[model samples]
Target: MLARSLEARGAEDRTDCVSFPRIELRLGKQRYWPQVLTCKLFRWPDLRHLSQLKRLCICGRCGRSPADSITVCCDPYHFSRLCEPETPPPPYSRLSPSNHWKTIDEPTEHDTARQLRRNEPSNSQNQDWPDSSALPSVTRDEHWCSVAYWEYRTRVGRLYTVCEPSVSIFCDLPRGTGFCLAHLHADGRHEMVRRTRGKIGGGILLSKEGDGVWAYNRSEHPVFASSPTLVRGHARGLTVHKVLPGYSLKVFDYQRAQALQRAMGPELPDGPFDPHSVRISFAKGWGPSYSRQFITSCPCWLEILLNNC
Candidate 1:
């Protein structure tokens, strides 16, 4: 009865009208009907028809409104189920090893405020050092700050902020413990100041703990007397004596490295060297390739060894 009804609907005249045969024929040649359909439906659909099918999906992880015509939650793992079998994975995994994993060795959580350690040698180790009164104070205070997960950008295409840490909200975080210094762009110069907080982790500013009674030093980084702004009911600013020595090299080490390289010439390797590898591998097997005379003297080459430790 169904066949008769289909036949009566024009029988021979409607033979070409049957879409399944045409689809099978195209598919026999490995043609992608569903992809063609999707591209037609999405990329070139009439605006009136397109508007009816368009939808906005929010990412479960990020709460972002993805493109109107695309499936929002189509994770790479589930792509096979999202469309007909012919569609391949999105040609790229943003998290793939070749791309994002190349620089995974470096840390994203850069403590910009950390200073160099005082005990570490600023000059050669054998040289006589100045007394405690003669040497300068290298300490700096840490302040607490955490960004909400929603606040961080999805992708950073630029150099500086490319490796920034992901932020998340923590309700039960510890109160009044951890602190790190951050350099904020103010006035003309990058001034160093100490800040404290009621909460330990996460990047939110709080108020100063005490009244505006802080000491000033003649030889240290300029101390600021003003109070920082607050978030919630907490004070984010406190007076810290010194940041670690690691933070100290962040400012001036690059310039010093370039100067040392020019003076040493090709006698030393052009850049930082792995001292442990030189000590273990080169000391045993390779001689001319990794020589001892060049390895010990170069400070820039030596520091990478120190940094590795």
Candidate 2:
């Protein structure tokens, strides 16, 4: 391909020239989990032209710049010039036989069950949860009604589907000491928030001042949050806010309260102060994994539904 490219150019080119056909690789039936490395090249016209002063044929086509581009990521052999290592696969467990593989086709029943089983609880939550009847009955006068709740989006603890089903609910939150939920620990202790693994953090505290909720990044790493009531509303669908460590974001969207407000509680007459239905998602890194994260929400306002309002 390089010889053909140079032949096609015919002469030394000064411009940032690049060409490649669409490349696809097929590895029999089980190729999905294997790492497919593609080297990325940058065409820095000025630098290569300068390097040409040494009479070096760095470039294959024009001999101006090197034909190879510096790689910034993912190609395992990238670290060194000659001694490159092999790219590894996902994990022994994730690999499946042809019969077990589920691509664009319908998943078999075993596949579905295997997928769902990944998000089960990890550690243990305190036993003293209020009964369903007690949740809706709690009043503004009671402190419990003032708090919010979070429910894991996927039964398999979607952040890392290969892991066990993690913690389900967090209850009895006080006005202060906002809880921090994160995926910091590498070992088994990741269930501090809700018994899940590989998740971002959220240190959520109810606003002492107003209906607002103040969220801080108590974890070592950064966290992202988003909601329909948030600045980048979910009407556009799945936007995000990056909340750095120690920093906080004021999250109170009374504007889009008509639909979500019903879940918050009947404190106001459908005007301001949307209830606990604030649904947001978090992840350790907002990559493809972000979509898999638990779509957690404040369960505090579930009382409104329990009241049959």
Candidate 3:
């Protein structure tokens, strides 16, 4: 049997319908080995030898971008830091079924008051912030919020919220445990795509008091907190603001309740210097390009969206 086969691949399949091949990546060290594999294969030619070992070099791996692999979950998604020049968004007819562009619920004075009362002083481990579990249930708590998933307009001025139901539900989660994030696919499904370990992991906790949320700098490095907010007036969309790490930020105050600490995790282990490969292979293309896959585990909000509430 043929171990693997090649098919027509590009940004799209041979027929050009979305084709997201499941990158059957068994982590051999690099963090996002799968998606990074796809990028190295289909996207670019910028990967040095894994750990700069000249014996197992690129001549054995370079330009070998495979097309077909394990059956995929859905179509591939292209994430660009650069927002595409505004284009017309999909009309209502072509839009996904779960999308709704609703304004985020802002905390009223009364709600904030209630949250403060519910979070009355106690023998909490962190005195500055109350325990997340002490607050009332989701239906009753003002601070019970989830990360809202939105599909923003690429060409037009609009954002469609597909899934925002269950991210921040921490009832079953362990107090100190951390979970990872997934990409909220356009089809109302989620696929794991980001990192969730090291200094920071998966998501943060929102304390009911002050409509407040606390982020931990679990990583040794500094992380910038980022939240997606609605632009004032007719803009009818979201913009992100970066908040520094080791602090608390107001939730419900932004379009999305969660934020991401923008740091690319601990550095990849610098392998023993192999002079032959260090001078040629590692120097040839993208040098040590692991951190670029994602800044944090699951990009925060999207990570929560993919969770079981």
Please tell me which predicted candidate would have the highest lDDT against the true structure: 2
TM-score quality measure for candidate 3: 0.24
Deviation in Å, model 2, residue 96 alpha carbon? 41
| Per-model root-mean-square deviation over C-alphas | 26.9, 22.5, 22.3
- Ranking by lDDT, best first? 2, 3, 1
**For candidate 2, what is the total of clashing residue pairs?**
14
* Runs in model 2 lying further than 4 Å from the true structure: 1-140, 143-204, 231-235, 255-276, 280-309
Each model's lDDT: 0.18, 0.26, 0.23
Candidate 3's residue-wise lDDT over 147-181, tens digit each?
32212111111122223112221112223222222
Where is the poorest 10-residue window by lDDT in model 2? 124-133
Query: Model 3, poorest ten-residue lDDT window?
Result: 275-284
What digit string (tens of lDDT, one per residue) describes model 2 on residues 163-234? 110111112212222232232222222253343222332232222112233343333344444433442222
TM-score of each: 0.14, 0.30, 0.24
**C-alpha root-mean-square deviation, candidate 3:** 22.3
Query: Model 2 — TM-score against the truth?
Result: 0.30
Model 3 ranges with Cα > 4 A deviation: 1-175, 178-203, 210-218, 221-236, 254-309
